[model samples]
Target: MSTETSAKAPGGLRTGVQKFGTFLSGMIMPNIAAFIAWGLLTALFIPTGWLGVEGPVEALRWSGSEGLAAIVDPTIQYLLPLLIAFTGGNVVYGHRGGVVGAVATMGVIVGAAGTIMFIGAMIAGPGAAWVLKMVEKLWDGKIKAGFEMLVNNFSAGFVGFFTGLAAYYWLAPLVKGLTDVLGKAVGWLVDTGLIPLASVIVEPAKVLFLNNAINHGVFTPIGGEQSTEIGHSLLYLVEANPGPGAGLLLALTVFGVGAARATAPGAFLIQFLGGIHEIYFPYVLAKPVLLVALVLGGASGVATNLIFDSGLVAPASPGSIFAVLIQTAPGSHLGVILSVLISAAVTFVVSTLFLLASRKRDLAADAAGEDKLAAAVAQTERNKGKASSVLGGLAGAGAATATQTIQNVIFACDAGMGSSAMGAGVLRKKVQQAGIEGVTVTNKAIANLDGTADLVVTQAQLTERARMKEPNALHVSVGGFMNAPEYDEVVALLLAQQNGSAEEAAAEETATHDAPAIDFGAKPDPATSTATAEGEAPEGATPEVLTRDNVRIHAGSATRDEALREAAGILEAAGAVTGDYLEAMKAREETVSTYMGNGLAIPHGTDAAKDAVLGSALAVIRYDGGVEWGDGDVATFVVGIAGKGDAHLEILQSVAIQFGDDDTVARLKAAETPDELYALLKGGLA
Candidate 1:
C-alpha cells in the first residue's frame, strides 16, 4: 500500500489556500500555551465554573483578596490580546514588529466597548509591523552612521502612533462588525442543527496544519462572545471536540498494523489528555481516505452535542478531553461524555473497514510469490538509481554504481523532530547492529533537505515534497515512522547491498576481460554533462578549498551579518575570493537567509556574483554563543562558500550530509580545536 496519494487540491487554489492557512496558523500556533493557560484559568475561576463559588468562598479563593477570578478575568481580557498582537507582529517583523503590533492592538482593545477585539488585534498587529518594516527598508543605507538607533526608534514610534490611530478609528469597528456577523451566523447554525456541517472544513483544515488558526483565530473568538451571552456556547465544541481524533486513534490501536498500532495508544493519550491534535495528523495523512472517517466522526460528535444541547462555558485550548470536561456546563457532563463515546464508536467502525481493505490489498500483492516480489523490488531499486543519476546529470554509469554504497541516510518529515527523529534513531540502531561502517544516519525537515543523502525515508504523504527537495536521493515511503516491518525491510536491503558488493569484488578478481576503472571521487565536469549539471563547478577545481587558516575554532559574533562578514574575511584572506564577495553574500541573504536549522548555516554568494570569486574556497567559523539567524533559529557553525560555479556544490552536499547526523552535529558543536572540526568534515566527505 503506497502512502502517496493526491490529497491536495489542484494548483493555484491550493497554493493560495495553503499560504493563507500557513500565515494564519503561524500567528496562533506559537501562542497555544498562553491560550491554554487562559482557558484553564477561565474554566477554574469563572462564575459558572466548578470552583467559582461566590461570597466568603470566593474570598478564600485568593486568601481574602479580590479572588483568583479577578486575576483570571483580567488576564483573558488583557494578556490574550497582547499575545495575539505580539505573535502576529513577530511573524511579520520579528521582535521589533512584536512590540509595535502589541502597541497598535491596545488601541483597538481600548476602542471596542463590548467585544474583545480578537480579529482586530490580528489586523492591527501585522499592519503595524508591516509599516515599520517598510519604513526601515526606506531608511536602509540612508541613515547616518551614528544615528541608526535614533532613526529606527523614532520611525517605529511614528508608525505605531498612526497604526494605533487607524485601529481606533477604522479597524476596530470593522472587526467588531465582522465578528458579530460570524457569531450570529454560527449561533444560527447551532439553532438550526447545522453546526455539524463544520466538520467538512475543520477536518480537512486540521490535516493541512491549520487547526490552530481555525480554533484560536476563528472559533475561539466567536465562542467567547457566545459564551458571554449564554452560560455556554456550542461553538466551542465544533473544533475542540476530541472525540473524533480519539476515535480514529482508538481504531488504529485495535486494528492497525506495524507502527500505527504501536504508536496509536500513546498518541491517543497525548491527543485525548494533552490536547495536542497534531499527534493524529500524520495518521490521517498516511491515508487520505481516512479523512472520511475523521469528517464523519467529527460530524457525529457535533450531532450528539446538538441532541443533548451540551456546551462549554469556555474554549478547550488544547482540545483535550480533560479541557472539554472542565469547560462543560455544570449539568452537561454526562451529555458531553456520551458525545465523545458516540464519535469514537462511529470513527472506529469506519476506520476498521478501511484498515481491513488496505490489509487485504497488501496481502493480495504479497501472494504474487517470493521470486516475482523480489524482482519487482529490485526493479524499484534500479529505478531509484536512475532517478538519482537523472537529477545529478553526472556520468549515468558512475551515478548508478555509486548507489551500491549507501553512505548517508536521512529520514525527513514535516517538522523533523517528531516521527522522523524517532525513525532515524530506529534506523541508526539497526545499522549499528548490522555492523555497517562509515554510514551516516540522520533526520531533517523535508524543506531543509539538501539532496545529499544516498537514501531518504519519509511518510508517503510527503514523498512528493521529499523528491522535490532531495531529487538525487533514493526515496522510501512508509505508512508510519514507527513501523518495525518497514525498518526490517530497509535493513535487509542494506545487508543485501553490502553482500552484493563483496560478491562483485570477487567477480572482478576472477574476470578475464579488462574494464576501465570508475573514479567516484572525481568531480563531474559540468560542460560535458546534461542540463542537470547547469550549476556544477568544473572538474580539477581548487584542491585545497578549506585550509587551516580559514578555520576559526571559537569566534565571537553578535549577529548573523557580523558572522557572515567574519567568515567571508577568512575566504578573502585565503585568496579564494575578493572583498566584493561579502556584499554578494549579503545580497543573497536578503533573498533567502541561509540558516539551515540544526545549528548550521551556509552563507554563499549568488551566481550573478561569480566575478567576485577568485577561486573556489570555504571558511568555517564556530560561535560558542550562537548567532541568531532570524526567526529564532540560532547557528553555531557558519560556513561561507565562494565557489565560482557548481564546483562548490559537492562540498555543500558533503556538509549537508555531515550535519544530517545528530552525533556529528553534536561533536562538531563541542569540538575543541579547528583540527577536530576539519577531521570530521574530511571524514564525512571521504
Candidate 2:
C-alpha cells in the first residue's frame, strides 16, 4: 500500500543566522522599502511643481531649490498608515487580494463601524470553533465528524469579514488617536532632545565623505524623503557603470538556469525594447547572496559616474542600454562602457563565487544524506474515474452525487476546515479557471466519509483514518494542501475528471449501454455516511479548492501569543475578535494534524482528531498523531509530510517541485525548522 520512498531528512548544524537573514530579506524589508520609497515619491513629487508639469520641457525646468523645499513638507502623513495596514495584513495573514482587499479592509477598519472587522478577525477562529462544537451536538455521530471542517472554516471567513469591518470603523480611530498622542510626545522630545543631537551628527555626516560634493551631487537610488536626490544620483550612476547590470544579466544566465535563464530573453524583450528593467527583480531575488554584489556594483558605478563627471539630461523611461546611451552626456559612451565592465566584473566574481559555494554546500549535504526526510512525492499511476458527465446530465443529482462521485477531489485532512478548507477555496478557483465545470469539492475529516471518493487527500497523520473511511478512494500524500503543485495538480485532476466523464458518457452512448454512469446513490456505504445527504456541505455539497491563481494571500501581521490575548484586544478595541482562536488551532493540530516538514511546514488537518492542527504547521508533528520524520532533509519536506490523506499522486509531485528541489534542499539544511522554514519559503517565493 505504501508507494512513497521513505527517507530521513538531513540533520546538521542549524544555520540560524542565515535563516534569520533570509527572513529579513523576505518578510521585513522588500515591501516595506517599496512602500516607503513610493510614499516619499508621492509626498515630495506631488507637492513640488512637478505635479503640474506639462511635458519634458516643464519637467526639465524644475528649480532644485523649490523641489528641495517641497520634499520635506509634512503633508506626507497619510501614507504611513496605508503602508502599515498593507504590510501588517500581509505579515499576519499572508493574503494579498490586491489593493482592494488591503485598502477596502483598511477602509472597513477605519469606517463608521470599523472596529467590527478587527474584532471579527480576533474572534473568527474561536467563534467558528464554538459554532462547530454546537453543530456537532446537533448532528449524529455518523455525520458529525465528517461535516465539522466545512462548518468551521466557513465560520472563520464569516468572522474575518466582520472583524475587518470593526477594524475600519472602531480600530482606526483608536489608532489615529494613539498616533496623534505619540506624535505630540515625539515632537516634544525631538524639539528638546533630538533636533540638537541630529544637527550635530547630520551636519558633520553631511560635511564628511558621507556628503562629499561628488558623492552627494551624482545620482543615487535614493529612498525616503531624500529619494529624489538619490534617484537623480542613480541616473548618473547607471550611465557610469553600464557594465554592472549587463554582467549581472550574464551571471543570471549561468546560475538561475531554466526559466530563470530565460529571464535574459524576457529582459531583453522588456528592457532592451520596452525599457522595463523590473524584469530583473526575480533574478535578483532568486540568488539573494548576489544582493550584496548588486549593491557594491551599484556603488562602484556611482563612484565611477562621480569620477568621470557623467550626467543625464533627460529621465530615461525604459532604463535600457539604449536609453542610458541616449540620456548620458554626449560622447561619454566610453565611460559608460568602462564603468559597466568594471562593475560587471566585480559583480560576476562575487556572485559566481557565492552561487558556487551555495551549490557546493547543497551537493555535500545531499551526498551526506541530510534532509532526505523530505523526499519528493512518490510517483505512481492508478485508475481514476470521472463523474463530471453524470453531474452535467443528472436532473436530480443531489449533494451526495456532487461530493462523492463527481470530481477528483479529496478533502482528506484531519481537521479539514482550517487548512483544507482554505486549500479547497484555492482549488475551486483554479478548477474554475481551467474551464472545468460541474465539479464538486469538499473536505471530510478522516474519521468519517465512506471510501467512495475519486481521491482521498489527507495529512500524513490521518492516512489511517482516510484509508479506513474511503478505502476505495485513491489516496495521495502531500504534506499540506495549501502549497503549490499540489493545488495545481488538483486542478489538473478535476479537469481530467471532467474529460473522463465526457468520454465515458460518449462511449456508453456509442455502445448503446443502458447502465447508469458511476452512480454514487447506488453505493450503499457512501450513501449511508453522506454528510451532504443530510444537507451539511456548502452550496448543496459542492466543495471547491482555493487556488493561488484566484485566492489572494492578503497582507497582514499577527503576534506570537495566546489567542485570548491577541483576539480579546482586537475585540475590545474593534468588537469582533470574539471566539477562542488559539484553542481552535491547537485543537485542530491535535487530530490528524498538519505538521509536515522540519524547516518547512503547514499546520492543518481534519476535525476528528482530539487536537486539530489549528490550520498551521512548523517543526516536529505538533500533535501525537503527527509523524516523526527522522533525519535527512527534514527541513525541506516539512510541508509535504502533513496532508498525505487528502491529496493524490500528482500533488505529491508538486510538493517535490516546491520542497524536493535542489535550492529548497540547500535552504532547508541551512535553516532552522518551523519559523526558519516559513521564512525561507516566503523569501524564495517572494
Candidate 3:
C-alpha cells in the first residue's frame, strides 16, 4: 500500500492546514458511535437530568445509583481519549499501531490528572505509532526469517514503554498547558458575547471534513470541563450545529438542478434526523463558493444561541436535531429551534442566489451540447492530476491492465458505511445482472483497504488516500458515491476485461513485429471482409447484423463525423442500409453527443431515419486516438446503428449493460482482431 499524502497546497501553511484537518477527521469520525453513547449516558444520568428525580419515579432513574453516576466521570475522562488514541494510531500504522497508541495514552491520562486528555491522546497516539513505524523500518529484513513475529512484538513493546514514559515526563504537561490556555481563551470569548465569531473557523473546518475532529477533539473536552462547572456549556453546541448543513440541502432541494435536486431531500433527512453530516460535504465541495453561505449561516446560528444563552446538558453525538432537542437545557428549547431556523434561512437565501447563477451557466453549457460538459469534466479531472499523483507509479499501471481476473472490488470511503455501502450495493446488483462471476464487492474504510482488492472506487476527494491504501488496485474516483456515472463505467471495464481474456490470450499468439505497408482507402482483407467477391452482400447467406466486415480496427478518425461515416460505410457494405445515414446521425449528435463514459459511443440516426435501414445492423469501429465527441468525451468505440423501428433497442441496451462493466470495455478497447471484438459483443447479447 502506498503512504503518499494527497498533493500539497501551493503554500506550506495551506498544506499543513489541509493535512491537520484531514488527520483530525480521520481519527474521530470512526468513533462517533462511542461519542454518542457517552453523550446519552451523561444526558440521562447527570444530577440535573431525568435520573435526578427523587420521587417514586426515582426507581426508574439510574441517577439514583451512585455507581451509575460514577460511570459518567470515568467515561468522560478515559473512554474518549482511549478511542481517539486507538483510532489515530490505527490510521497511521494499522492494528499494531492502535495497541501502541492505547498503551502510550495511559501515561498522558495519568500525568495530566485526566484534564483534557484528548489533546494528550492525540499527540501520544500518532507519536507512538511513528516511533514504532521507524523502528520497524530500521529492522526491516534484518530480523531472522523464522523469528520475525518475536522481534516485532518485543520491539513494539519496548517502543510503547519508552514512548509512554516520554509522554508522562514531557508531552503531557506541555499539551495540558496549551489546553488550559485554549480553554481560557474560549471562555473569554463566551463571556464577551463574541462566541459566535468562532463559527468563522468552525464552519470552514467542518467543510474540510473536520467536523468530527473539531467537535470530538477540540470542543468536547472543553465543553465537558464547562459542564462540570455550570451544568452545561454552549461550547458543545458550537461545532455540532446542524442548521447550516440542513439549510444548504433544503436550498438544493428547492432550486438545485440535476442530481442535486433529486439527492438533497434524502441528504437533508440523513443530516437533520440521522446526524450524518458527511452527506452534505460533497455538495459544498462541488460548488466551493457555497462555503460563504455555510460560514454565514453557522455564525447566525451561533448568534442565536448567544442571544438565548442556550446550552446543552451534554454533547449531541450525531449532531442531529433530535439529539440537540434531547440534550437542550430546560428553558432553551425555543432558542435552539430558532437557531436552527435562522441558520437554515440564512443559508437558503445565499445558496439560492448561487444556485441560480450556476443554473444559468449550466443552461448555456447544455445549449452547447455534451461536448462542453465533457470538456468541463475533463478539465476538472486534469486539475486533480496533481492530487491523483499520490498513486505514484501505480497511476497509469497496476490493475488497470492486469490480466488476472478481478476477484475483489472494494468501494472505500472515510467512514466505510453510508455512501460507500450504497455504491457497493448498486454495483453489486449490476454485477449480478451482468452474470459476472467470481467477484466479491464490498465497502471498507479507506484506511482499512488491505491491497487485496483488484479495484478500488472512492470519492475523488479521497482518491489519493485510497490509492495510498491499496496502490495495486485499479483506482477510480467519482464525484459522489451515490448515483455516480463512474459506477457504470467501472462495471463495463471490469466485465469487458473478464470476458475478453481468452481473446486477448489468443491475439498474443498471433502478435507480429512486421508492419504491413499502409494503403489509403484499401480494400478489406478477403478473409475478414464483410462483402462477397463482387463487392455486394453474399448470396443466400443469413444476414450477420454484426460481422467481421462490419468491424473496423483502429479507424483513427479525426472527428465524430468521420468516425460515424467510417462505421456507416461498414454497415452499407454489409447490405444493412441503403441511404445516406451520416446526415441523420449527425443531426442526432447535434441534439446529444453519442459519447458515453468508458471510451464508448453509440451514434445512430433519428426515428425518422429508419427508412435508411435495410435491416437491423450494428457497426463497431475502434479508434486508437479516439475522436472528440463534443464536450471532452472521446469515443474509442464508435458503434454506428441503422435499425428499422425499435428492432435495435434491445441490442442497444445490451451494449449499454455490456459497456457498463469497465473491465469488459477495457478488454474490448485492447482487442487486436475483429474476431475478438465480434466475440465479445456477440457474447453480451447472448
Candidate 4:
C-alpha cells in the first residue's frame, strides 16, 4: 500500500496520470547513468566541446567514428532505449519478458530509423510483456508435468516473434507521430514566448510531489531529444531549478514560526546544495499562501533562462547547484547562475511578506504545540494515499522527528461481506479496547478500495489484486478471520508510528535502537501470570461461548470435508447448534471455501440458515499435521461457530485480536489438552 501519494497517486484523474507518469519514470530512472555518460561525452569531445583544442580526440569527434565520440550516438540510439524496454518488461513479468521486450524494441528502433524510440519502447516493452503474461494464464494449470518446458518455450517464442513484428510495422509509426506532436507543442510554446508560463503548473505540482514525473518522465525525453539536436535544451532547467524551494526555506528560516522555522535552515542546505528539492515541500504545505512565492519565483527563473538561452546538456538530478553547474553547457554559466539567484530572491521576498502577514496566528499555533511541519507531512502522505521514497528525505516526516502517522486502516476482501466484515469487527473492537486513538478501521470490497486508506488488510489470495487497485496505501495480508493474528502486528505498528519513532519505519537502517514496547496482552511476564494446574482451564474460560469442552488438542483430519464435518459435530455435541446446521455449513463451504490464509479455517452456517444455530457458542479443533483445505491452503485449526442471530460475531470479536501474535498462536498449538488450550484463549482475551 502506498498509504501514500499526493504525487503519483490514489485518486481518480490525478491518479491515472500519476500512475502513468510513475510507469514511465520506473523505466527511465534506472537508466539515468547511461544518459549522463552520453551527455558527458557530448560535452567533452565534440568539435564545440570543452576539448575543442583539437587532437586525436578531436579528430575522433562525432564526425569521426573511431573513438569516444563514436560511442555516443550508438549508445543513445541503441543501448538506452533497449535498456528501458527490458526494464519495463521485467517489471511486468521477469527475464523472459525482458528478453521479449528487448527484441520487440529492436523492431521499434529500426522502424523509426533516425528518431530515438524512447516512447516506442515505453509502449511496446510493457505491451508485449502484458500480452505474454495473459497468454501464460490461458494455460496456467493445464500444462502437463513433463511437457511444461516445451510449451513454455514455444509460447514465449511465438509471443516475441509476433510482438516484434507488430512493433516494427504499427507501434513505431504511431509513437513517432506522437513524439513529433509533442515537439511541435513545445516549439509553439517557445515561439510564442509563453514557455515561462509553465511554472504555474510546475510549482504547485512539485509541492504535491510530482517533480520527478514532470522532470524525468515528461521533460527528460523531450529535453534529451532536443539536446541531441541542439547541444542543450532549456526544458531540462524548467523542473530541475532548485531556486523556488531554496527561496521558500530561506524565508521560513527568517520569518516563520515553530517547527517550520526551526527546520528551514537544515532544509535549505538539503535543497540548494544537496539538490533535494523535496526537502522544502512541507513549508508550502504548512502555508499554502507561500505557493504564490513559489510560482513567481519559478517563472522568473524560467524567464531568465529563456532570455539567456542557457540550459544544461543533460538532466540535473537533485537539482542541486552543483549538479546544475556540472551539467551546464559551455558559455551558459552566467545565465544559469543569475537565474538561480533571481528566482531565489523573488520567492524569498514574497514568502517573507506572507509570513509577516500571518505572524500572530503562527506564533499562537506554536505556543499551542502545533507541529505544522509534521502535520503537513502527514497531510502529504494522506494526499498521496501512500508512502514515497523521495518523501523519506523529510527528516520529521517519518524518519527524523516523528514517524509517519496512520489514521485510516481499511480491511478489504472480495465482496466486502462475511469474512472481511468479521475481520474488521474483530480489529476495530480490539483497537477501542486498547485505547488506540486517531485510528478508524473499516472494511470495503477490494473493488471499492479508495486511495484514502493509510493501510489495507486483505486475505493473501486477494492481496495482489488489492495492490493493483490502490498501489499507494500500505497493505497487510491475514490468513483467517477467527485467527486474524495479523491484527496485533498491525496495532503494534500503528503504536510505534503514533509514538513518533516507528522503529521499523526506518527504511534505511543507519542506526541501532531498542524495540518499541508492544501492548498486546498475549505476552505477559511469568511474574504477573497466575499459576494453575497444567491441564486445568483458567477461571476466565467459564465464559458461556468458550470452555474446556469447546477446545480439542489433537484431531485427525485428512481433507477439508473431514475438518468441516468434525467441527460441525463438535458444535452439535456442545448443544450450540442443531443437526440441521451441518447442512448449512456444508452449503456455505461449497459456496465459499472456509479456508482462510495461514493455517486456520472458520466454518459457520449461512445468514439464511441462522435458525439452525440453537445458541451462541464456539468450538476449536487443532490438526497435528494440518489438513488440506484445497487451492494450496492448509488448516491446522478449525473453529466451528453457532450463534443466535449473529452472536458468533461477538464471540469472534472477543478472541480474534489475541490470535495475531506468533507466540500466542504457538502457545495454542503447543497446548497438551483441551483445558490448556481453552485456558490460553480465554486468558489472552480476558
Candidate 5:
C-alpha cells in the first residue's frame, strides 16, 4: 500500500537542510514549554516588561535572590539547553544516551559560559550520543554474556567523560563562533531592509513541511539569544507569521472550485484560530502559481514588522492570534496586529486576482472531476517526502459533513495489499475482542473505493484522495496501522454507539484491562470481516501456510532490493509460488511501499502476476538492523505472501495479531536464537 514514511529524504542540499532542521526541531519542540515558562517570567519580571517597575525587582534579579525574577537566567542558561540535550539524546538511544548527552552538554555550557549556548547544546547533545552509539558497536556482541550491564554502563560513562572534555576544549568555541556569524548575518539583513526577503525561503518551505525546522531549528535559538539581550527579536516573526496562510485560505473560500472551495471556510477558521497552517498547503501545492501570493504576503508582514521595529519576546508557536498576542514584545501589539492584517490583505487581494484569472479553467476542471486541491494533497506528500499526522487529521476537519452509522470499515492505501490489510486485521482483532458484531472491516486500494463503505480509514496523507473517491463516507485519518490509537478510538465509538454516549462507554471499556479511556466513535456492531472471508482455509493449527522452516530470523538484507529478493526467495523455496513471482513482487514494491508501521513490512505480488501462485503460503523474516524501505522507513519484519485465492489470509491475520503491538515486537527482538524466535512465533501464531 502507499505507506509514506520519513525515509525518502529530498535529494542533495534540500535533504541536508530538511533533515538537519527536522533533527534540530525534534530536540527543541519538546522543550518549548520550558522556553515559554522562561518567556512569561521574562515578560513580566524584566526591566522592559509589562510591569516595568524597575526597582527591587531589578536588584533582586541581579543579586540572584530567591525571588520570581531569579528563575529567568538559570532557566535559559542551564535548564532550557539541558532539556534540549536530553531530548536530542533520547531520540538517538533512549535514557542512557539522554543522560550521557545531558552530562556532556554541561561541559559545553560551562565552557561557553558567557554565550547563551543554545546552539552549543544542539551540537553536543546529539553529537556525543551518536559517538557513543558507534563506540558501543565496537564491542556490541563480544561482551561476555554475564557482564553485559557492567560493560555497557562503564563504556557509556567513559564516552560521556571524553565527549564532555572534547566539548569543553573545542566544540564550545566553534559553536559559539558559528552563532556569532549567524547573528551578524541576521543583523546585516535587518539593517539593510532585506530581512523581508527571507519570505522567499520561509513561505515555500512551510508548504513543504519544513516550517518546524526553520522556526525551531534555526530561528528559535538565534532569536532567543537576541531576546535575552533586547526584549525581542524579529527573527521569530519571519516564519511564525499566520497572515500569508490566512490570506490564501480566505481567497479560496471566496473564489475557489468544488471541494477546495467547499472546505475553505472551515479550514480558514482552523488555520487562523488554531494556527494549523498545513491545511492550506495543499491549496498552494495544487496550484503552484498561488505561491506568488504567499511570498509577497509574507514579505509584506516582515516589512511591516521591520518598519515598526517590532517583534515577539518568544516564538509564537502555531502562529495563532492568541499565541501571537501573548508573545508580542512590549508595546509592539499594534505593530504585530497591523502586520498580520496587512499581510492578509495583500495575500487575499493577490490570491483573489489569481483565482479570478483562472476561474473558468478551474470550474471546467472541477466539472471534469479534477479536484486540484484533492490531487495536490498527494503531490504535497511527495514534496514533503513523507506523511505528516498533523496534515492527515486536517482532511476531515472541514470535510466531515455527515454522521453515518458504521457497518463497513474500509482501510485503504495505494495498492492495499500490505499496510491496509494489516490495519484491517488490527481493527478486526479489536472488534472481535470487544464482542462487537455485524460490522465488516476490509482492506482496499483507493481506486477500489465504491461508496459502499460507511467508514473509510487511510493514512493522513491519503485521506483527501480517499475522500474524493468516496465523498459520502466518514473518513478517519491515522498515522499507521500498527499500534495506532485510532483503533481504540474507533472501538470506543462503536462501544459507545452500541450502548451509550462516548463518555458513558468509558467505564464499560475500563473493565477490559487492555482498553484505555473512551475516545472513539462508531455506532453499533463490528463483525469486522476477517481475511477468512477472502477464501476459507482448511481447519488447522497454524497451517502449513506458515512454519519454522518458512521463517528466517535475523536475516541480513542491506537494501530494499535485497530485502525484496530475499523475501521472494523464501516464498519460492517454500513452493508457494513459481519463480516468476519475484519480478511481480519488485513491480508491486516500486508502485508503493509495503512497509507497515511498528517495524513491519509485507512483500507480495500484484494482481497482474497472480498466475505465478502455485500454493498459498507465508514466509516471514526479521532483519537484524533493518531493511532500508523507501520514504524514510525501516522494516524489521518482512512477510512474503503467495496467496491462492486468499488461502493465506488466516496466517496473515495471525501475523497481524502478533506484530501489531510494541510489547510483542519487544519480546520478538529479545529472542536470542533462531529456536527461541521460532518458538515464540509458533506460540503467537498458533
Candidate 6:
C-alpha cells in the first residue's frame, strides 16, 4: 500500500500511432480485394448473371438504399470496446469473462463510455481490485501475490480506455488544430531554409524501410479502397493476418508463458482466444525500451511490403491468421514474404531478450547435472543427524542408539517470493528458540516438498502440498514456528526432549533466565483419534488415511485460530496454498464448512486450497466447534482439507477428503445432524 509510481510506459501516443499505422497497413491489401469483389458483383455478375440476379448496375437502379446498407451494415461498432475490455480484463485478472464481475465492472465502463471507457476504466480497475481481494481472501491469499500485477495492469486499461476515449473525443479537434499549426510552422521553416536542415536530419530516422513498406506496399492498397467506399474496406484492416501475424502471435505466446508460469494459463486464454492485445500492454510497459523493437519490426515489415508492392486479395477477419495469408494477391507475394520475415525477426530478437532476462533468476539449481549433486550434498549435510558419540555408544551398549530427533520446527510462507523465504526463516528461528542444536530444519518448494520433511511449516499452497505430499509429515508436523498453532505440541515435545520435565524447566529457566518455560500440553485431553480400521469407509471411496502418507500438521497450535494457522503451515509444507489466510479463515468462521458434530471442530481450509482430501481426520476433540463458529451452527469443526493431487478416488489419502462430496456435505450440513453427521462420516469411511 505504498503510494509510489514508476516512470515507465509500454507505448504512448507514438506507440498508438504506430499500432494504428500497422493496422492501416494490414488493412490496405484486404480493402483492395473487397473493392474488387464488390465491383465485379456490381458490374459483370449483375445484368448477365443467372437466377434473375442483377449486380450493382441493375440493383442500384431499383434500390440504391439496399446497396448502401450492404456496405455499412457489416461495420464493427461498440463491440470493439467489449473486445478491448475482455482482453484487458484477461491481461489484468487472468480470468476469462469475469461474467458477473465484468458486468458490474461494465456499469462503470458504460458510465464513462462516451468519453472513451475512461470513467468506466477508472471504476473498473478499483472494482476488479475489490472483488479480487475477496477472491484472494477466499483462497487464503495464495494466488494474490502472483496475480496482483495482472490485476493492476489489466485494470489500468479500463482507466486508460476511458481516458484515451475522452482524450480522443474531446481533444481530437484540439489535436487537429495543433497539427495544422505545426504543419504551417514547418512549412514556413522549410520556406525560410532554417527548418529544411532540421528536416534533413530527422527525415532519415523517420524514413526507415518500415514506413515505406507500410505506406507504399500495404497502406496504399487499403487506403485506396477505403477512399472509394468499397464495401466495408475500413473494417478489413484489423482482420487477423495469416502469415507473419500468426508467427508474431506464436512468438508472443512462448515469451509470455516463459515469463509467467501459473499466470500464463490465464493470460494465454485472454490473448489467444479473446484476441485482446491490451493484456500484453503491461509487458511492454514493464520494459518500455522494447517498444522500439516492435516499432522497428512493424516498420520493417511495412517497408518490405511496400518495396515488393504486395497487395491483399480480400478483407480478412482480425481473428483469423489463415484468412490474411489466403487473401494476399498473387503479384504482391514478395511483399508478403518480406512482411513475414521482418516482423518475425524483430519479434524473435525482442522476445528472446525479454525471456532470457526474466528467466535468468528462476532457473533451478538442478537444471544442469553439476548443480544437482552439489545441492543434494548440501541438503544431506543439513538434514543428517549429529550427536555425541559417547552417549550413543553407552546407549548402544544398553541395546539403544542415541538418535537425534527433531521435536520442534517452523514453516513459513508469504505470497510468492517472500513466502518460501519466510518459512525457512521461521524454521531457523524456532530451532534456535528451543535452544536445540543439530536439529534438521530446512526449506523446500511448497509444491515439491510435500512429504519429504518430518515437520512441515508453510504459508499457503505449501500447506496444501504438505497435506498431499507428506500426509505422513503431519503427525510430525508442528504448527508454524513463527505463528502459534491450536496446540503447543512443539513446546510439549521440546520440554519432553529436554534434560528435565516441564515443571523442572519452568523452575530452572525462571530462576536462571527471563524466558518463560514453553508449555506444549495445552490440550489436556488429546483430540479423539479419528483413525479407525479400514472397514468403515466413505460413500465415493475409502476414507483418506491420516497416516504418514497424506498429512502434515504443525506441532504447536494457537488459541481459536490455532487450526487456521496450522492450515497454512500444512499448505506451505505441501505447496498447494495461496491468497490471504486471515480473510479466508474469517469467511470460513462465518459459515464453518467443517460441520464436525459429536463434540468436534473439524477445522479445514477454504475451497481455494487446491488439494482434495477425504476429511483428513474426524476431529473427536473434547471441545465443540466454538459457540462463535459459523453462526453457532458449528460447535465442532470437522475439517476436510485436501490438495489438488486427490482429484480421483485411488489417490485420496485421508478420511476427511470425502467431506468434499457435495451430497455428503449437504447431508452433514442438514442432518439432525451430529448423530446423522457421525453416521454419514462413518458411512463414508465405511
Best by TM-score: 5
Q: Can you give the lDDT of residue 293 in candidate 6? A: 52
The residue-level lDDT of candidate 3 at 318 comes to 76
For model 4, the stretches where C-alpha displacement exceeds 4 angstroms are 1-10, 53-66, 211-213, 388-686
Model 2: ten consecutive residues of lowest lDDT:
379-388
Write model 6 residue lDDT over 298-321, tens digit each, in one string: 555544554554535344433243
Please give the TM-score that candidate 4 achieves against the real structure: 0.60
Alpha-carbon deviation at 52 in model 4, angstroms = 3.9
- Better-scoring candidate (TM-score), 4 or 5: 5
lDDT string, candidate 1, 1-686, tens digits: 21122212223544455556556656766776776666566555566554666322444343323377677656656787788888888666666777889999988987776786778878888789888877776656676779977887888788889998888888888888898888888878888989999999998877664455567677877876765555466777878888888989898888876445656787788889988776676667556688999899889888988888777877676788888887786556777888888887888889889988898664454455222222222222222211111112111112233354677788775534234544565566556566556776666666568767788876543566677778777766553232233455456556557765433332322222221122224464443221112222345743656766777764232367778888889989888888898997786565434565567777877545768888867788887646667534567888887764444444554454455456557777777888877766655432
Q: What is the per-residue lDDT of model 5 for residues 1-686, given as tens digits with 9 covering 90 to 100?
A: 33333222246876666666777777887777777778788777776676545522443334222266667788888999899998777666556767788988998999888678788888788788778778886776687878978887898899899999999999888988888898888889989999999999999988876666677766888898888888788888888888998999999999988888887887788888898788789988888899999999999999999999888888787678788888887768788999999999999999999999999999998889675664566566656665545454444433333356778888887655556766887787677677676787888777677788788888755676788888888777676466666666677666655665554355345334342211112111223334333323334233356667877765222467777787788888888888898898877666555776788888888656768988777777777656657644667788888876544554455566666655667887778776777777665522
Q: Lowest-scoring 10 consecutive residues by lDDT in candidate 1?
A: 385-394
Candidates 2 and 4 compared: the better one by TM-score is: 4
Higher-TM-score candidate of 2 and 3: 3
Candidate 1 global TM-score? 0.63
Candidate 6, lDDT over the whole model:
0.35
- Give a tens-digit lDDT track for model 4, residues 1-686: 32112112145666555666667777887887777778787777655666643423544334342355666678778988999999888666556777788889988989888787888888888788778878887866597879877887898789999999999999889878887888889878878889989999998887775655677665777887887787778898888898888988999889988777777888899889999776677678889999999999999998898899888888887689988988887667788898899999999999999999999999998899676776575456544433233333342232223334678777775544346655776666556554467887766666677677777876544555677877767666555564444555566566566664344433212112211222223332232121111211123222366556778854223456666777788888888888888887776665445665446777777555757777767788887646656433557777887754333433443344444445556777888878877766665522
Best by lDDT: 5
Instruction: Give TM-scores for every candidate, taking all chains together and pairing residue i with residue i.
Output: 0.63, 0.34, 0.54, 0.60, 0.74, 0.28
* lDDT score, candidate 4, position 254: 92
Question: For every candidate structure, what is the RMSD over all alpha carbons to the true structure, in angstroms?
Answer: 11.9, 19.2, 19.8, 13.2, 7.1, 21.7
* TM-score rank order: 5, 1, 4, 3, 2, 6
Off by over 4 Å in 6: 1-75, 79-299, 302-320, 323-337, 345-686
